[model samples]
Target: MRTWRLVRVVTLLLLAVSYCEFFHYYMVLLLCTWPSVSSVQGFQSHPLRAMFIGDTHILGSNAHWFDKLRREWMMTRSFQASMLIHSPDVVFVLGDLMDYGTESSSTEFEYHVQRFKRMFSTPFTTRTEIIVGNHDIGFHHMINDKRYERFKEAFSAPSVRLISVKDVIFVMVNSMALHGDGCSFCKEAEDALKNIKWQLKCSKGKLDQEKVAEICEKLDIMNYSRPILLQHFPLYRTSDSNCSTPDAAPLEEIDIPFRIKTDCLSKESTDLLFELLNPRLVVSAHTHHGCYRLHDNGIPEYTVASYNWRNKHNPTFFLAELTDQDFIINRCSLPDEHTVFTLYAIFAILLVIVIIIPPKKQKPNLGKSFTPSNKDH
Candidate 1:
């Protein structure tokens, strides 16, 4: 009986440990990332106050407005608190501004994009950059130039554009064009890369060659000014090359497609780009999973968790405090519903255990019956 009791104790301990780990993540979702609690405005002197959210996949319509409204409302509050405190200048959406790049016409898609813009216009106040993802261009499919052009114009951005603010320059690139598989916009993408390289080399800390490079002088760019590279894909799954990894993680199948594996960036191109670009920081969205890790070369890279709750993964995003040359990444995505649901699950299992196992009844009846002689009954 003692041995059985010891086994039971050990089992309980193991379960407790497992639950403790689960509880930690649950609390983070409930407290740190939950949108109900509006964010505190950050300091004003912050260089660039921006929120980075990924893969909204918002199904914008009357039927789903409630969910959309609540999520964005919470996000706005969070953004405001970030601004009130961190003082971000804008929002950088990693990509997939539309829900139906797969089927919707360019005009329809553009309308949706504009709607998205208007939705955030009130809260965002400043500029909000919407990067294009595979979903925006049809995942793993060649992009239609006509559609991509319309999308770009609607957003009033180039295939690759640069934004300069407070000694920081943000370079946005369309990775769909960079696939190097004879994509329609491949030439434009190649040109964009060349332009970026030239701008960085000749302009030296200035977005325009004509403007004086005060930022370069102030930040001492003669040495090396690491620019922030934004895109929709990652270079590597595990290694720390400044390139992107696949948009999706490796599946459990025996064989996967070559294109799928290198869908984000080919190893050869990744290596060349790293040598040419030398991006100090890499930010991307594709994988719903949230990640922050340094490249093998030491540049920090991140994949913000998807904002949409429709995915199998938990909703996640990050509070990026862009410190001078590096980034202070604070992940805030795991949400209230997830926590509540997890808690309920754990409780349900425990309740079932209680219900299923009968309680230990006192063995008193047997003792009394056996002790009849002592009672002299």
Candidate 2:
């Protein structure tokens, strides 16, 4: 009986200790480390400047942590407040702002909407544009969620949106609906896809050729000599896939996984998208692993890392400074000091739990001489 009692006490104590440690880890992660503004060494002013961010994936249950991190990074203010402290002409979010679409409740959806409203609240000299990602569409395998519709309602539009800033045109397209079985053959969506497809395609495929022409025509209409393309998925090879160069190392060699389902866009669609847009530069993020490559075609595509729990060391953003001679792209990491401190704080909490939950004590047994039969005799 005594032994059983001791074991029960030990179990209860351990459970209590674990609970405390878990709560402490989350608290420190959300509130302890904050980011500060830092300057890029050789930033230059452009006729127009733009800042790009993607794959935020904020939710009410876990948004506080993101909010804390964003606040630290000085992202809650205008773009001009940070690296673009001079004030960028525009801000673009590539996609995946929320984790899941319509399945996300009103409260959860509103939480993400509010976070954006707060983060980019500063008056911008340029426009703010957003593209839809796979998560924003909800269940890309099927079109039943209608989450994209909700997102449109919250964000104010669907399909493609064009912004002309400082005589430069920025085209933001919804890539989620293109290849997903859920949206296959959606007439309106198909038409939009066809329009984008025609502008990008350059070869024998009618759809591809049409897309390329359309994009060129759009540039003509804008009369812009240089444009920038922004999308959630990259048109080039993904981090997990085989590289174009035989000498290149595989993704795993670089600490990236072979497949990240949420980040992948079909190779066929990406090739088509890249071929048509042919922008001066392309920026995207979904792979979580940051990648910078100048394709054989001379187009530069950059994938920004994420600011989530999974990507602890790679929370990052891009700074593009336009100069007369050339445009410079700088990939910057958020403060590492706070992240390191947070990690230590978590370790300390776990250690405390171990110390507080004492091991079970062995109970003393009654002697055989004290048996009931002997006592009776």
Candidate 3:
């Protein structure tokens, strides 16, 4: 009886420990709700539900096994939990998908990609799209053909891509290629941007029919929508010091200056992108913290926080409901690393206590034990 009681208690404790580490994400299934724009809430359109994840930064060979396992598990659980609840039509990974992608060999890079797929796997009905990040390839000045090609092959990511979902056009750009140096990659990116611009113009009925026939023969867009710019780097910004949004960089780091073209796109590149794309909304992920800012042109940009625990204590993602003329972005947070660790610590202490403290020894039933059965004598 004592053994069984002890076993039951231990099992319950183990279950609690599991919940602290893994099952915690399951709560978000109930907690997370699809936020709606009040004005458009009553609209009868089937809004395109899209989930955006920031830098996953799947660690490479150099990371410790425990760190890799912990971080990856957190990402997997959070993503899968939210996916189950939201059932988004499309998912966008806003770059920096790997930590050492630029440094890894072909085999190592492949492994990272495989691991990322496992971590962020989604249902077949939901489409996944990715954009290239500086880490996925390299900085413009240091990018090489081998690295760039391997990344593109791995993720099917291009320097610039246009995807239309539910009449909402998402312009995915490789921010790394926006160095404005007119290198071969830069030139290619610019050309793709021009093509995308023409497609948008055609959609808006702004281009002459002849112009559309000349350049937009392949674009089969049936409805018009402003482009939503998706990239790996944020637009030009000095720093997040003045950013008042929740989950902005920590107070101490907010004032640190961002390096032009490295931390953010160069001013020239930013101007060129805005002029060409004329995006109604922009979403980027390289900063690894949340920032909601409106450009001088009055377009809103949401910088998603990193989805990986290694980047921030409180990781988060963006849930966007997009329509042809409206977009609503909600910042959804994941389980905090510090909170999870604290729970683990607490559970470990309780588990130790359960093991160390002896189960009470039941007082022997003296009457029954000592009273001998009167056999027939």
Candidate 4:
């Protein structure tokens, strides 16, 4: 009888253990999976407003804190929805949509896609454009692989496309080649640019002295106003190697891979490219640090902070409100501890189920024996 009681206890304990495991697994999956919605509202009018968000690095397999950060992001759906409610004509995501290229999968990537879809949905169907970032290109390892192919396949279409919006001719440049493992695409890009330049001239467009000038000339001929260049890397001095500022310490600056480099259009090749492009406003994000500056030539370049674990302190986004005459730039900081606490509370509940519930279930079956004592009396 005692043996049977022991077996019963063991069975209950096993069931409790199984239940805990299943619950934890399901919660984790829920945390990682893409969110779904019934419907997306459309914008009511045309020529609406627009905003720019950059570097949302939403991938990691590390500590619970990472999941907490992700949950915080998940909660921002309402915040983003409010922006759409204000009727932004378009939304520009600068770069670094995902943290690791190697970690890209159908399921994982879909999670990111769904997140963006939820945040950027509109009533009148606002357009959302995404530019390729360094992480999107696989950093240093194999360049232009399945992940890249998948990204292009997913976002290269007309819906989530690359095109000029209104007066701002947005050019989504793939800047990963500068730090990619090979030089194949780098050469190919250079060749493509040369061909594009020729095509512009053939179309009766005069070439400018600088690369920016040529690009602007071509865009101008196409009826595009001042071009706003969007790339993954900053065009200005991101490092203090050339200039000095009290706030410009090496540690204080964003430390990207050593393979990648940045300069303010004076590094010969890159300088020529920027000078020719002569973009009115250049927006980029890769260093995960945020900065906004105006060059001597009156061009403004802004770097957006990342929405990832690395940039927890400044987990914010840039909002560019464009009018007919000019645009206003605003930095909106994401929600901090309130959202984080909700996630922690969820994990804490799971921890209790996993560690406490099973042991309590196995505590001897004393109630069963006591019930039968009535017959003996």
Candidate 5:
């Protein structure tokens, strides 16, 4: 009886844990899908609204089952986001366009892009740009100039590009640059970063200005209201400080350890970039979980969740409305119908198998061991 009771208790505990997982994400979806009552009535589309996606990791032929699952789930979730109210005018694909991006994989890459395009449901209407990711360049967690060039040929996108939405600037940086030393692409990225400073010089007043006569006069050169930095890896896992430990797990996904582990970005370079360009917002995706916090400078930095991750119950994307007053960012979950169904089905099956089955009865003795006998004593 005691053993049966323990078994039941264990099953109940397991069920509770699973329920919390589903409930947490479902609630997130519900909350994000609906706008507040005031916004529903008064809200109109902003002039330059944008949608941001996390790492896609689009898989190709002869890939593992998980990769295939990731691809399909991401497509469904992305489609759902696009269909929602206040849909984006421009969609920014941060990076990781392919599982292991290469010119040789161009066919697979193009196919994924087309599928993604269809999913977004804005093939021709909405403008979209993809930046280079570490995988896109096949740099072994670093940047390879040759592969970077080939990635451009494969996709016809620059390694680093600047996008403008009204007065807001989205600077896409090639995160592969800081993956290793002696990277030629790093130099190219530097020049690109330099150009960004010049372009956003007039927007500096928005960060902190008394709006004095001199500052107001300089506003003529205002080509941007604020700058948003987009990249693959987070600058530091948090808004402040650096995170680089060789002993830390290799940042690669599901691969047997073979290469020397290194931090996602070099502390030196990240510090320099931060010093040179203190962006109004920083968004990135590499870790499969999502995070939103403010940098030491009070700038918002978001580490987005991967759509391909099943464990990350709340697969998320971002929506931004660049209003005159400020930029409002909302994180929305990508609802995966199939996964949700599978989870519930498994839970139900476990309950029936464990709780519905009865334990076998054992012989009972009254204060003494009972021997098999021909007749009862």
Candidate 6:
């Protein structure tokens, strides 16, 4: 009987340890319920619930097996739980889809894609949009036709394009091409942006349809709204010195001056985007930290933190309730890595103690048994 009791106790303890190790993700989701969105008067009855994930940086050749498995599991659990709980209308993955993306061969890239798909699989109704990051292809100096072609083939990533959800328009750009250097890649990106500008102008009744007959036939330009600019790099900024957000870049990096076209888009590139797109808001991710900057023109730009635990202990993403005229963005953090691991460690310790310690033996039926025997005699 003691043996059976010990077996059951050990089994339950093991299950407890397992829950702390894996199933704790769901608990985090239950605890961090999606932020409530304020209803705007002019907005539709239901605003678009858009989920924005920051740089995932899924590892490639550099990852150890255990590290790769652990990170992927965490991401998969968080993503799955978020989808199940939030039921977002759209998911925007804000670049850096893979670490060493530029270094991966075709086969390696395919494997990475498969892994990403497995972790981030969504329902058919939930649309996903991905932006191009420097890591996915390369920095301006390292970008080439071959690398660009591979990424484009895998993701269908155009240099710049426009996406419309409900009445909201999102102008997604390949920020890496905003180097301002007139390379072949840059020229193509520049041309695409110019085309988007013309389209926007046409939508606002500033351009004659007769002059651009080709583009006019492609869509009902009059129906489009002012765009929300989406890109991989933040606009020109000196540094994060002025950012006061809790998730802003580390204190050590706060005062470090940013390099134009390295840490952020060049001044000229930023100006061109603002002049052309006339965006209502801007969203970017690359620094793996959160930042909120109100540009000089009064436009708000939000830099989302990384979604992968490998990047930080407290990974985070954005939840934006969007409309044609207004938006509400809430920064939601994933389960803390340290907390999750600590919980698992504690449970594991309890499990080890349970297995090591013997179950207490029943202390004496001594007097009772003797009395029964004497009465029978």
Global lDDT scores for all candidate models: 0.60, 0.56, 0.86, 0.53, 0.61, 0.84
Evaluated against the true structure, the overall lDDT of model 1 is 0.60
Off by more than 4 A, model 3: 1-9, 38-42, 208-221, 366-377
Assess the local accuracy of residue 322 in candidate 2 as a C-alpha lDDT between 0 and 100: 47
What is candidate 2's lDDT per residue for 261-302, written digit by digit as tens?
A: 345556666665555555677777776556777867788877
Candidate 2 has what TM-score? Answer: 0.61
Per-candidate TM equals 0.64, 0.61, 0.91, 0.60, 0.64, 0.90
List of clashing residue pairs for candidate 6: none
Give the C-alpha miss distance for residue 116 in model 1, angstroms: 1.4
Writing each residue's lDDT as its tens digit, candidate 1 over 110-184 gives: 667766765555344566777887777665455666767776777766667766665567778776666666555
Instruction: Predict model 5's lDDT versus the native.
Output: 0.61
Using lDDT, give the best candidate's number: 3
Spell out the clash pairs found in candidate 5.
Answer: 167-225
Model 6 segments more than 4 A misplaced: 1-9, 34-43, 207-222, 355-357, 364-377
- Model 3: per-residue lDDT, tens digit, 68-167? 9888878888888887888899999998899888889888988888988988889998999998888888888779999999888888988998888877
- At residue 99, candidate 2 shows an lDDT of 64
Better of 5 and 6 by lDDT: 6
Q: Candidates sorted by TM-score, descending order?
A: 3, 6, 5, 1, 2, 4
lDDT of 4 at 310: 43
